[model samples]
Target: MSSGTAAGRSRSRSRWRAGLGRLAAGTALLTAVALLPWLSGNDPALTVLRARSADQDPSPEQLASVREQLGLDEGPFTHLVHWLGGLPQGDAGTSWVSGEAVLPQVTSAFAVSVTLMLGALVVTVAVAALVSARTLYLGSRRRLHRATGAVGVAVLAALPKFLLASLLATVCGVWLGWFPSSGWEGPASMVLPALALGVPSGAMIGGLLDQSLPAAFNEPWARTWYAYGFAPHHVARHALRRTMAGVLPQLLPTVVALVGGAVAVEKIFNIPGLGRLALDAAIAQDLPTLQTATLALILLGTVAGLLIQVLRRALLGPALRDGALPALHAPAAFRGRSTRWAAVACALALLTLVTAGLLRDPLHVDTAARLVPPSAAHPLGTDALGRDLLARLGHGALRTIGVAVAVTAVCTLTGLLLGMAPQVGAGLTEVMSTMPAVLAGLLTTAVTGPSASGAALAVCLVGWTPYAAQAAALLEQERASGHMLASLSFGAGPGHLLRHHLLPAVLPPVLRNALLRLPTTVLVLASLGFLGLGEQPPTAEWGRLLSENQPYAELAPWTVLCPAGALVLLSVLALSGTDAAAVRSRASVPVRMSRRSRRRGVQGHARPAGSYK
Candidate 1:
C-alpha cells in the first residue's frame, strides 16, 4: 500500500513537471511574438504616422497625438503588460492606418481563414487516405508502383504553392469559367484556392502515408491478423489504426507549413484572410495592424503545436506509459540509388532548359500574333503583347531558378560557417528567423526597387536560419561522436578537427538541408514576384507574368494558364532534383558497419588518405 502510494506520487510529480515545461515554452513564445513590432526596425509611433499620413510628413502635433494614443509614452514592459491583459477580453487594440478596432477585422479574417483551412485539411486528409489505400492495395511486392507514386507525389509537392494557385485560378476561372479568377465569394471560388493550398499539403501527407502504410502492413501483428482470415481491407484498416501514432506526428510539420503557405494562397485568391491582411500591413508598415495579426497568427501556431502534442500523447498514451516507441528509423529512400540519379538527371535537364532561355531574347515582342493560342509556330501561345509564351516561360524559369540557387547557396554557406561556432550565432539566428522572408523581401524591394537580386537577399536573410540551425545540430553531434572525442584526445588542433574530421561528417546533412530548402526558396521568390517585389515588368518571370496578364485573363486565358503551367513544371523539376540529391547524399554516408569494410580496415596497415584525422 505504501509502495503504491509512492508510485502515484512520482507519477503526479512527473505530470507537474511536464505541465510547467509547457507553460514556460508557451510564455517564451508569446513574449517573443509580442516583441516583433519592436524588432522590425521602425519606431512604432513613426510607423503609425507614416502609414496614416500616406507618405506625407506628419506634423509634430500629429506625431505627439499618435504617440499618446498608442501609449508609446508608457514604459515598454508596461505597454506589453497592458496589451497582454487586453487579449483575453477580445481587445486587440486599434489599427494604425484605418483607426478601426483590430479584433473585428482579425476575427472576421480568422473566420475566412479557418473555413479555407478546413476545406484544405479535408482535401489533404482524403488524398492521403486514398493514396495510402492505393499503396495497400498494390501490396508490398509492387516496388515499381510504389516508387512511381512516390516520385510523382514528391514532384507535385515540390511545386510552389503560389504557382499551384495561379494554375487553378486560370484554368477554372479563365478557360472553364467555372469559378471567379480572384475573389472569395461563393463555394465555387473557394474550390480553387482550397485545391491550390491542399495539393502540396496532400503530397506531403501522401509521403507520410507511403512510409507508414508499408511498415504497418509488414508488422508481425498485421501478418498474424491476415493469417486469421481477415479481409484485405479490414487488415489494412487495422494496420493503419495501429500505426497511426507514428504517422500522426508527420502531420505537425505539414500543418505548420500550411499556415505559412496560407499567406501566398490568400494573396493569389484575393482572399481577405488574416494572412493577406498581415502581408498588407507589413508592406505598408502599419505597426498596430501588423503586430495584432502577427500575434494572432503566432498564437494560432502555438495553439496548433500544443494541440498536436496533446493529440499525439493522447493517441499513444499506452505506448508512452510503456516506453514502447521505437528509435528513429532511416527514411525509406536511403537505399534508392536510381531515384537519386533520376533526380540529378532532371535537375541537369532543367539547367539546360534555363541556359537555352538565357541565350534567347525572351522580351522580343511581335504585334501580329497577339493572344495567339498554342500552335506549332508559337508553342504555349502568345501573351496579350504577342511575346512568345515559351521564351518568356524559359526566361522566367531562368530567373526563378537562379534566385533560388543563389539564396540556397548563401544560406547553406552561411549556415555551415555559423554552425561551426553555434554559440556565436544562436541569438542572432533566432532573432532573424522571426522576420518573415516574404515581408523582408517586400521591404527590400520597396527600398531597392523591384529586382530579383534584392528579393534573393531578403530571402537569404530569413531562409538561412533553418540551414544554420541544422548545421549547428550536426556540428554538435559530430563533436560528441566517439571518433571526434578520440581525435581530440590524440591532440588534434581545432582547425585540424574542423578541416579533417568535422567537415566531412557534417557535409552530408548540410547537403540534405540545402536540398530540402530549395523548394521553399523558390516559393519565396515566386511570392515576392507575385507581390510585384521581383524583377520589373516584361522580365518574363513566372510570378510577374501571372500579375501582368491578370487584366487580359478574360480575353486570353492562355496567357495566364501558360505561365502558371510553366511555374508548376519548373517547381516539379526542382523538387525532383532535391529528392535525387537527398537520396545520393544519404547513400554516400557509410552505414554503421559493413562486413567487407571491417576486414579491409583490419587487414590494411595504412589508413586510406581519405580517412584523415
Candidate 2:
C-alpha cells in the first residue's frame, strides 16, 4: 500500500478508537450521574424536602410521595435508561429545590456559560497571537525582551482567576465604572469576567506559542518557504498555522481548565452560569439539579474536545497524513535571578507565618477584641469573631499548603506511573482531562460530603491528567529521539530503555511542571473552599477564610487581605521556583553532554568534538 493510503487508514482506525473511548467515558459519566442520588448516602426525597423547607420535619408518607414524584424510588438502571431516553427529547427532569424543569434551567445557564467561554476563548486567542507576534518581531537577539515576556506570561498565568476577577471588578467595574461588577446584565458585564478568565489563559497559550513559533520558524519547510522569496507576512502566517497545529493538542486541557475555572469567576462576578448553578446545587444537595448540570457540563466538555480535535486535524492536513511533524520538545528555560530571590523571600515569609501561627491558637475567640486592627498582640489583626487573624492565617497555611503539597505529590507520582505507557496513559488522560477539577469537586462533594478531604480528593481525581499528558508527550519525544532509536538498533530491551532512557529524560521536566502547578492546586482547593465544598467555617482554611471575611472587607480588610495576600505570595513562589528549576535543569544539560562525550572518548570511539557542531 502507498504510504499516504496507509496513513489515511491509520487515522481512520485512530478515529474509531477515539470515538469508542469517548462513548465509553460518556456512558461511565452518565451512569455515575444517574447514581449520584444513591451515592450521596442521603434520601433524595428528604433532601428535597429539606431544601424546600429547611425547618420542616417531614413524615414518611411525604418523603415517599416525594420520592415517587421524582422517580427516585426506581432502580438506578431504570433511572439511567429513563434519563438517556429523555435526553433525545430534551427532557432533563425537574429541579428538586426550585421545582422547575431541569432542562430549561440547565439550558439557559449553559447558554450563558457558553457565551462567557466563547468570549474568554476569543480573548485567549487574541492575546496569544499578539504575544507570539511581538516575540517573533523581537527575534533571538533581544534576550532581555524574551526573558521579560516569559516572566510576564508566567506571572499572568500564576495569578489566580478569582483574584483577578475581584481586581477587575473593583478597578474596572466599581472604580472606573467601565463595567458592572456583578450580574449577567448584558455583554457589558461580560467584559471584566472575560478579561479575568482570558488574560491568564492567554498568557499561558502565548507562552507556548512564543516557544513553539520560534522552533517552527526554524523548521526545514519554513526555511524552504522563506528561501522561495515568499512575502514575510505570508511565511509568518504559514509558520503560525503550523505551530498552532503542533500545539493544538495541548490546548484541549486548557479548554477543560477554562470551563472549570469559570466556577470561581462566575461566583465572584455573580454570573448565573452552569458552574455557579452546579456549585449551588452541590451546596444545597439538590441532586436532580446537580446531576443534570453535571451531565450537561460533561457533554459540553466532550463536544469541545471533539471540536479541538477536528480543528487540529484540519490545521495539520497533509502534514498529519504524511507523518511529517516531529514531536514537540519542552520549552527552553530563561534564567531570572530577581524571580528566584522573590520566590525565596515569599517562601520564607510564608514559613514564618506558618511557624508563628502554629505556636499560637487559631480557634481561641476573644469577643472583646473583635475586628481589631493590627496591634502589638495581633500581628495580622483580628476577625469578627475576635479570632487572631495571624493565628488563623498561620494555621490555615498548614491546612491549605499541606493539602496542596500532598495533592501535588500524588498527582505527580500518578502521572509518572501512567506516563510510562503513553498509549494507555494518553487515552486515559484525554478522557479524564475533560472533567475539570471544579466539576470533579462537585461530584466528590455529592458523594463524600463537603470537607477538606473531599476537596483534595476531587482535585486528585482530575489533577493527575495534566501531568500524565505532559509525561506522555515527553515520552513520545524521547522514544522518537535519535539516541533511543540507536539504542533500539543495539538490541536494548524495553526494560533497559525505560529505566535508563525514558524515566531519566521525562522525570525532571514533568516534576518541574508539577511544582509549577502547586499554586494552581492551592487555588483549586481555595476555590472549592470558597464555594463551601471544602473546609467548613470554624476551621482555619484560606478559602474558607476568604469566603467568611468577604462580606466584612470594609469593616476589617485584614481578614480578607491576609489570606488573599498569602495566596498571591504562594503563587509567586511557585512560579519563581519552577522557572528557576527549569533554568538549572537546562544549564546542566550541556555539562552532562560534555561529560558523556568525554566518557566516549575514554572508550576510544568518540568522534572529533567539532563534528557535533
Candidate 3:
C-alpha cells in the first residue's frame, strides 16, 4: 500500500511537471499574441514612413483615443492579463488598420491555409509514395536502384518552391495554358499552387524512401523472400510493409519543411491561403493579421509536429518513435547517411550527364551553340533572355553552390555559437534561446528594407537560435550527469572544453545539420529576393531573377525555368545528399550489433544532424 502511494505520487509529480511546461509554452505564445496590438501600433516597425516623415505622426488626442480603443496605453503586464482573459472567449480584438474584428479574417485565412495545406499533403504524399512503391517494386527500366533513386530524389529534393511555382506556372499556364499565372480565382487556382507546393515535398517522399528502402532491402523477411525464390516484384511488394519501419518519424520533420515551403509557394502563386495572408500581413505590417497568422501557423505546425509524433508511434511503433523525437536519432535513421558517398558519386555522374547533354550541341557557337533548343544545337533550348539554357545552368552551378555553402557557413556557424554559448551560462543560454529570434528578423527586415546584409542578418540571427538551444540543452544534460567533471579532471578549461570536448561532441551533428539548412536558407533568400528585399537587379540571384522575370513568365517560360530549375537542383543536392549520408551510415553500422543497439540513445540522438532527419 505504501509503495502504491509512492508510485501514485510520482505519477502526480510527472503530470504536474508536464502541465507546468505546457503552461509556460502557452504563456509564451499568449504573451507574443497579446502584445500584437500594442507592438504593431506603437513600434515604428509596423508602418512604412517615407522620407520627411515627421515622427510626430498622429495627433496626441487622436493617438490617445487610438491607444484607449486598442488598449495600447496600458502597461504590458496588465495588457497581457487583459489579452489572456479574452483569449478563452476568442476575442482577438480589432485589426489596427482595418478597424474590423480580427477573428473572422483569422478564421477565413486559417481555413484556406489548412485546406491548401491538406490538399498539398494529399497530392505530395500520393505522388511520392507511388514513386517510392514503383522504385521499390515496379523497377525502373535501368534497374539502377541508386541512379533511379538519385534521379527521382534530385527532382523531388532540390527544387525551391518559388522557382518550382514560377516554372509550373510557365509550363502549364503559358505553354499549355492550363492554369492562370497569378491571382486567386477559385478551386482550380489552388491546383497549380498545390502542385508547386507538392513538388519539392516529393523530396520528403524520397527521404522516406531512403529510410524505408534500405530497411526493406536488408530485412530478414526480404532474405526470406530470396529463399522462397519470390520474384523481385513480389519481394518488393512484400518488403514495403517492413519498409515503413522507419519512415514515420521522418514524416514530421518533412512536414515541417513542407508546411514552410507551402507558405512561400502560396505567396508566390497568389493563393489565398493562410500562409500567403500571413506573409502579406507581415510585409504590410498588419499587426493583427500578422500576429493572428503567426499564431495560427505556430498552432498548425505544432499540431502537425504532434500529429506526426502520434502517427509515428502508431505506424513505426514505440521503439522507432521514441528514437526519432525528444531524443532525435541518427542521420542514418532519418536519411541513410552512410550511403551518401555513393549518392554523391551518383549525383556527380548525373550532373555530368546534364553537362554532357549541353556541350554536345551542334551550333558550335560558344555562347549561342549552348543556346539551341532540344534540337541538334542545344538539347534544352534557349531561355527568354536568349542565354543558353545549358550555359546558364552551368553558370548557375556557381550561384547554386555559392548561395548554399555561404548560407550554411554563415547560418550554421551562427547556430553553433548560439547552441554552444550555454556552456558558459545556463540562465543566459535559456534566456537567449527563448528570445524572439523570429521577431528580431522581422524587425531587421522592416528597418533595413531587405538587402543581402539584411537577409543574411535575419537568417543568421533566427536560424542560429534553435541550434543554440539544442546545444545548450545537450551540454546541460551532460553537465548534470557529471560529464563536465570528468572533462575538468582531464585538465580541460573553457578553451579545452569548447574545442576538445564540446566542439568534438557537437561539431559532427552541427556540421551535417548545417548542410541541410543551406537549402532552406537559399529558398528563404530567394523568396526575399522575389519580394525585392535582396540584391539589386542584374546580380542574377535565382529568386531575384524570378521576380524580375515574373512579368514575362507567360511570354518567356524559359527565363523562369532556367533559374527555377537551378533552384530545384540545389535543393535536391542538399536534401538527397543529407539522406544519402544517413543511408550510407546505416549500411556500414557494425553488423555484429543488432540494429536496435546501434541506434543512438535519446540524448545522443538529438544532435544538430537529427533536426533535418
Candidate 4:
C-alpha cells in the first residue's frame, strides 16, 4: 500500500515536471520570437516602411516614427513581457507591415490550419487502421503479401509531401475537376491538401502500427487470451489497445512534425492558414505577425500533445495499470530476397548516374543547343543555359549527398551523446523539436541571408532533436530492462554498463533511425532550396534545379523530370537500403554479443586471483 502511494506520488511529480518544462520551453520560444526582429539585422522599421510603400524612400523621421509605434526601440524582454501581458486580454499587437491587429488575423488563420490538421489526422487514423487490419488479416498465412504491403507503404511514406500535393492537385483538381486545387472555398477544397498531408503521415503511422501490433500479439497476455477461448476479434481488439499504449507516446513527435510540415502544405494548397501567414510575415520581416503566427503553431502542438496524452491514459488505463506495455522495437528488417535485390538495383543505378555525370562538363554552356531534348549527344538533354543535364545532376549529387551524409552523421552522434543524459536532454529536445526546419531556415536566413550554408545550418539545428528524442526514449527503455537491472544488481559500473549494455542495445535502433532520416534530410534541404533559401542560381543542386526549371516545366519538361526523378530515386534508395542494412545489422548482432560475453568472461578469469581473499 505504501509502495502504491509512493508510485502515485512519483507519477504526480513527473506530471508536474513535464508541465513546468513545457511552460519554460514555451516562454523561451516566445522570447526568441520577440528577438527575431533584432536578430534579423534588417531594420524592422525600414522593412515595414518598404512593405507598406515599396517605392517610397523613407527618411530618418519616418523610420523612427515607425520604430516608436511598433515598440521596437525597447529590448526583446520588454516586447515579450508586453506580448504576454496582452495575451490574457486577447491582444497580440499590430503588424508592422499591415498596421492591422495581429490577434484576429492569427486567430482566423489558426482556425483554418486547425481544420486542415484535423482532416489530415482523420485520414492518418483511417490509413493506420486499414493498414493494421490488413497486416493482421494476412498474419502468418500470407507473409509475402504482408511484406509487399509494408514495402508499398514505406515507399508511399518516402514521397515528399510537396510532390504528393502537386500530383493530387494536377490529377484530382485540374484534370478530373473533382476538387478545387487552391483556395479554401468549402469543405471540398480541403480534401486534396488533407490527403496530401495525411497520406504520407498515415503511411508512417500505419508502418509503426504494422510493427507494434505483431509484437503485441506475441505477448504472453495475448497467448493467455487465446487459451481462454476468447473470440479472435475480441482478442485482437484487446491486443491493439496494448500496442497503442506504447505506440501513442511515440506519436507526440509526429504531431510536432505534422504541424511543422503544414508550412509547405499550406503554401502548396493556397490555404490561408497560420503556415502561410507565417511564411509571408517571415519574408516581409513582419515581426508582429510572424511572432504571433509562430506562437500559435507552438501552442497548437502543445495542446495536441496534451490531448493525445489524456486520450492515451483514459483509453489504456487498464494496460498502464497492468504494466503490460511493450518496449519500443526497432523496425523489422526485410526478410524477402526480392526487397533486398530491389535495394541493390537502386544503389547500382544511382552509382551509375553519378559516375556517368562525373565524366561530363556540367558548366559548359551551349546556347546554340539550349533546351535540347534527350538525344544521342545530350542523354538527359540541355537546360536553358545549355549545360548538360546529366553532368549537372552528377555534380549536384556530390553536393546534396555529401551534405546529407555529414548532417546525418553529426545528428546521429549528437543524439547519441545527448540521449545518454536524458535528464538534461529531454526538455531541450522538446523545445527544439517544436521549431521546424522551415521556421529555423527563416530565422537563419534573417541573420545570415539565404545561402546553401545557412540552409544547412538550419537543418542541423532541428535535425538532431528527433534523433535525440529517439535516443532518450530508447535509453530509458533499456535502463528499465531486465538485463540492465541485473547488471546493476551485479555491481556493473556506469562506464561498463554504458559500453557493454546501454550503447550496444541503443545504437542499432538509433543508427537505423538516422539511416531512415536520410531521405527526409534530403527532402528538407531540397525544400529549402526550392524556397530560394538554399543554393542559389547557377548551382545544379536538385532542389534548385526543380525551382529554376519549374517556370519552364511545360516548355522544357525534361529539365524538371531529370531532377525530380533523381530525388525520387534517392528516396527509394534510402528507404529500401535502410531495410536491407537492418537485415545485415540484425544478423550480426548475435555474433557481436557472443564476442562481448567471451571478453567479459576472460576478464573475469584474468582478474588478480583472490585479491579480496
Candidate 5:
C-alpha cells in the first residue's frame, strides 16, 4: 500500500517534470513568436494610432522621435530581447495610441477578462459535465439519457452566445430586472456575461462529455460492477473514475483549449477575458495590444494543455495510458448486411438538402398555413419582404446545412492529417488556434463585402485550426506508441501509410470534430447573416429569417419561431449524429481482462436465469 502511494506519487512527479518541460519549451517558442510583433514595438496598434495621431498634425520631427521612443527604430531582434526581458519585469512596453504605460492599462483591462473566464468556466463546465455524465452512465435510464441529450443538442443548436446573451440581458436584466446589464461593479455584473458564456460553453462541455461518457458506458469493469449487484451509480463511478485511462488523455488538450478562448461570448457578455482583450485590439488593429493579448492567450492555452497532460497521465496510469485501450472498429451503417438505418440517415439528409435547394417546405406547412393565420394573398404570410416566408426559410435551412457540411469536411480533413502525421510541426497548429474566429469572420466580411461565399470562407478558415490541432495530437499518440514505425517496418511507404494506417486511425476523431463543429458553423452562419455580413435582408438565410421576422414576432411569432425551430432542428440533427458516433466510439474500448484466471473470465458472461418470470 505504501508502495502504491509512492508509485503514484513518483508517477505524479514524473508527469509534473514532463509537463514543466513542455511548458518551458512552449513558452520559449511563444516568446520567439511574439517577438516578431514586439520587435516592431508600436506594432499595428501603434501604427494605426500613430496615423490617427498624425491626422492631428504632429510635426515630422515629433513623429520620428515618437517612433524612436517606442523602439520602432530598433531591429526586430533588439526589440525581442527588450520585450522578452520586460515581460517578467512588469514592463510590456507602451501603448502606441495613448502613449500610456502599456503594462498598467493592459493589466487593469485584463483582470476583468480573467475573472469572467473563470466564472464562465465554472458555470459551464460544472453544469455541462454533470448533465452529460448522467446521460453517459450505462445504468442511466434511457429516458434520462434521451432528455439530457435532446436538451443539450437543442440548446447548442438554437442559439449563438451573443444572441443568447442579448436575450438574457433583455429579459433578466431589463424586463425582469433581475440582474444589471453591462456594469462591472457587483455580483450581478458577472451574471449576464457568465450566462451568455455559459450557454454555449455548456454545449462545448457537453461535447467533452459526449466524448467521455460513451467510453465509460462500455468499460468492462463497469459491467462487472453491475453484475456484482452494485448500483448503476457505482458502475458509472468505476467506468468514469477509471476512464481517465483512454478518454481523459484525449480530453486534456480540449480542456486546455477552453482556457483563453470563446471570443464572441466574451465580447457579447462584456467580459474582460483574453478573448475580449484580443477582440478590442484586433478591431482597432492595435498591434501592440493584439500581440500581447494573443501571445498571452497562446501562452495560457499552452500551459493549460501541459497541465491537462499531467492530469491525464496521473489519472489514467497502467490500464489505460499512451492511447493503448483496444478500439472496437465497426463498419459504418453502409457495411451492415441490411445497412438500412445508415441508409435512412443518409437519405433523410439528402432529402433535406434537395427540398432545401428547391425552397420547398419539409413540414407540410403550406397546407397547414391557412389553419393559423391570414395575410396578403399568402395566408401563411409574407415576410417583411412579402416573399413566401416559409419557402425562403426552408431554402435557407438547406443553405445553412450545406455550409455546415462544407466546413465540417474541411475541419475533418485538416484534423486527420495533423493528428495522423508524426513529425509535423506543432507551430502551425499553435498559430492557427489563437486566431479569433469572429475577427476572422469580420475581416472576411470586411474584405469580400457581404456574400454567402465570404461568410462561408471565413468560417472555413477559422474552424480548421482547432480540428487540425486535435488531429495533430492524436497523430502524436500514434507516433509515440511506435505505430508509425510499425507501419514503416511493414513496408508501408508514405502513400500507403496515409491511405491505410493514418486515415483509419484518425477517422473517428475526425467524425467527432465534424459532429461538434458543424452545428457551430451553422450558428456562425446564422449569426453573421443576422448581422448582415453575408446575404442581404431579402435573402432567407436563418439569420436573415430571424431578422426579417423580428418586427412581426409579437403578432406572427411562428413566422420567426418556425425558422428558428428549423435552424435548431438541423443543428440538433447534426449533433445527434455526433452523439451516436460517440456511443459507437464508447462501445469500442475493451475492459482489461485482469481477473487473471480462465474460470473467472468465462463466469463473467453468464446471464441470470429468468425462468418464466
Candidate 6:
C-alpha cells in the first residue's frame, strides 16, 4: 500500500515468521529449564538417600520410605507442579548439600558474581577506551607500532581467564604479598579477582576497538574536519565516539564469554559465585542445586540477549533494509610482517615447554621431601607424595595440549567436509549445538570407561558443532560471492570452483574457528577430570590434580595451587596461539565489503550485521 516492493513485503513477512519461531523456541527452552529436575536421570529418592546415608548403602525398605516421604513416587507432574506453584513465593527449593533453602544461597552467590561481573565490565570498557585512544595516536603508516600492538593483543587475548587469575593469585598474593590469595572478605580482596577476570575481557574488547577505530578515523567526515583546520586530536576524539557506536553490537558476545569464563575464575579465587556453586552441584550431582543454577544461567543469558537486541535496534535502527539484512564483511587483516613471527614465537615456546616436560621423568617420586614448599632445589614445590610439581605440570601440559590439538584437528576436518553441503550442515549443526557437552562427555566416558582418549573423543563430539556451524556460514557466503558466480558463468564445474575458490576462502575461517574453540575444549577436559570422568592419576591432568590435592589443601596448599597455576599457564599459552592466527588471517585476506557499505562511504554506518559472540 505504501509502494513497497514485493520483495520487501515478503522479507517483512519472513522476519515476522522468524520472530514467531524464536518465540516458540524460547518457550520450549523455558519449559525444559522448569523440567530439568525430572530430566537429570537420577531418581530423586536415590539421590536423597545417598546424601543421607553418606558412603553407606541404604536398604530397599529405606529407599521405599524415602521415596514415599519425598513424594517422588507420586505422579511426575505433581512434583513439577508443586515446584512451579512455589515460584511466585521465590522458593526455588532446598539445597541437598546444606539442607537449606536454595533461594538464599543462590541469592548470596549471585550477588558475589554480579559484583565481580560489574567490576570486570568497568575494567573492560575503561581499558577498551584507552587502547582505542592509544591506537588512534599511533600514526597509520607506522608498521612497527601496529605490529607491537597486535602482538600485545595476541598475548593478552591468548591467555585464558583462569590462567590469568592463577598468576595473579601466585605472584601478587602468595609471592609478592600484595593482596590476599583467596577470599571474598572486602573491597581490597576484590581487586585481584577483578583484574584476573577483567584484563582478558578488556583485551578482547580492546582488540575489537583497535581493529575498528582506525578505519573509522579514515572516513571522509573526519578527513573533512581535518581539511577545515580541525586539530588531529579533535578529529580523533569524534572518530573514537563513532567507533564505539559501530562496535556496540559486539557486547552480546562479550557477555556470553564473560559468563563462561567466570566459572573458572570463581573456582580459582574461591569466590562462592554462581559459577563455583554450579561446579559444586555438578560434581556432587546435586540435582536441585544443579538445576537451579542451570536455570539461573539460562535466564541470565536470555536477559542479556534480549537487552542486546533492544539496544541494537535503538542504536542502529531496523535490522533489515530493502527486504534483506545488510551483508557483513570480515575485518581486513593487519599487514604487519611481524605477526607471523609472533605466532611462531608462541608456538616455539609452547613446544619447548612440552618437549622439556617429555624429556624429563615426571613420575619419579621422592618420599623423603614430601610436601616440600617451593625452593631453589625444587621449583613449584613437591606434592604430598613428593612428586616434582613442575615435572607433573609439564607432563600435564603435554597431555592437555595434545588432547586439545587432536580434538581441534578432528573438528576442523569434520567442519570442512560438512561445510561443503551448507544446507545439510546447517541443520545438523543446530541440532548438535543444542546437545549438552557435559551430557555427551558423560555418555562417552561411560561407554569407553574413562580414559584420556575417551575424554578427548567426548569433547570432540560436542565441540565440533561451533566450527561446523562457522564453516557452513562462511562457505555459504563464499558460494554467494561475485567471483564464485563469475566462475560458474565461465562454465567452471563444482570441482574447479572447489579447487580454486571455496577451499582458499574457507580455510582461514576454519583455522580461526579451531583457535577460538581451544579454550572451551580445555575447560571441558579439566571439568571432566575433576569429576573422575577424565584421565586418572599418574597422567597428571590438571583437573585430576584439583580432585587429588583437595584433601591436601589444608596440609599442603601448594599441591593444589601449583597444578592450578600450571593449568592457567597452559591455557594462556594455547589461547595466545589463536590470537596470532587471527592476526595472520586478517592480514592475508582482502576483506570484501557489502555493496551497502561501499555506497555509504565515509559517512555511512559500517556496523557488522550479526555475530555469534
lDDT (CA) per prediction: 0.62, 0.71, 0.52, 0.71, 0.54, 0.59
Q: Which prediction has more favorable TM-score, 1 or 3?
A: 1
Q: Which ten residues in a row have the lowest lDDT in candidate 1?
A: 604-613
Q: Give the per-residue lDDT of model 2 (tens digit) for 287-376.
A: 667778777766766676677667866765655443344433333544446666777788899989888988889999999999999989
> Residues 1-613, candidate 3, lDDT per residue (tens digit)?
9977886887577446434543455456546544543443434222422111334565566555555665545655675565446768998656666667877988987776667767777777877776675556533121423423544555565566666787787788767888786777677777887787776666555444543454445434445556657677666654454344334433443444444435556656766666556555555445556656556655654555446435644543432322322211232343333345544654685486457634543222354332244555554566444445555455445564576577668756765665455323222222222223234345556556657776666566445533553454344333432333444554557874564345544554445445545555666666566556565544545566555556665655665666666555555566566555555544443342224223422222112221112
Pairs that collide, model 1? none
Estimated TM-score for each candidate:
0.68, 0.84, 0.65, 0.87, 0.69, 0.69
Better of 1 and 3 by lDDT: 1
Highest TM-score: which candidate?
Answer: 4
lDDT of 1 by residue, 1-613 (tens): 9977887897677456545544454455445444545555656677777777665777788878888887766745675677668888988777767989988988888778778877887878877766566666754332322243555665666656765677678778778898887878877777888888777777756655564455455444455655666667676555455445444544543554455447877877888887778787876556556667666655565455456547755654553443333211223343345555655666676566566556656888889989999887776688888888778877777666677778889888887787566445633443344445665665566556667888888787667755665555445444544444545665668886665556655665456446544665666676677677776676777767766776676678788776555545554454455445544543443342233235434211112221211
- Write model 6 residue lDDT over 1-613, tens digit each, in one string: 5566775786577456535544454344445443443555656566666665674677788878866766665644665566667768988777655678888777788778777777787878876666555677753322213423655654555454565677688779888999888889987778888887777667656765675555445444544565567666665665555444335534543554454336667777788888777656654445456556655655565466456545644443332222112112323434455655655665676566566556656788999989899887676678888887777767887667678788889977886786566434523443334334454455566457677787788777656654554455445445544445555665667876675566655665557546644645666677667666678777876666665665576567788776554444444444445455555654443333234224434212232222100
For model 4, what is the C-alpha lDDT against the true structure? 0.71
Deviation (Å) of 119 in candidate 4: 1.4
Clashing residue pairs for model 5: 44-287, 45-286, 45-287, 113-272, 113-273, 418-471, 418-472, 419-471, 419-472, 419-475
Q: Roughly what TM-score does model 4 have, to 2 decimal places?
A: 0.87
Candidate 4 residue-wise lDDT, 185-282, digit = tens: 88999899989888877776676566555544544555566566766777666656655654564566566766665777787778898777887787
RMSD of 3: 9.3
Higher-ranked by lDDT: 2 or 5: 2
Better candidate by lDDT, 1 or 4: 4
- Candidate 2 or 6, higher lDDT? 2
lDDT of 5 by residue, 1-613 (tens): 9977886897677556545544554565444444434433334334554445655555667666656766665654675576668888777876656656666666766676667666776777666666566555533322222323543544563565555666677678778898876667867788787767666656664654545454345435444554557666655554454433334433333333343445555554565666666555544545466557656665655555556556755554543344333332222221122222433554585466446435444233344343244354443455544456556655666566767788778766765665444235344444445455555555666567678887787777656655665555444444333334544554556875554444444566557656665656776666566656666655557666665565565556666665565555555565556556744643342221113113333322112221100
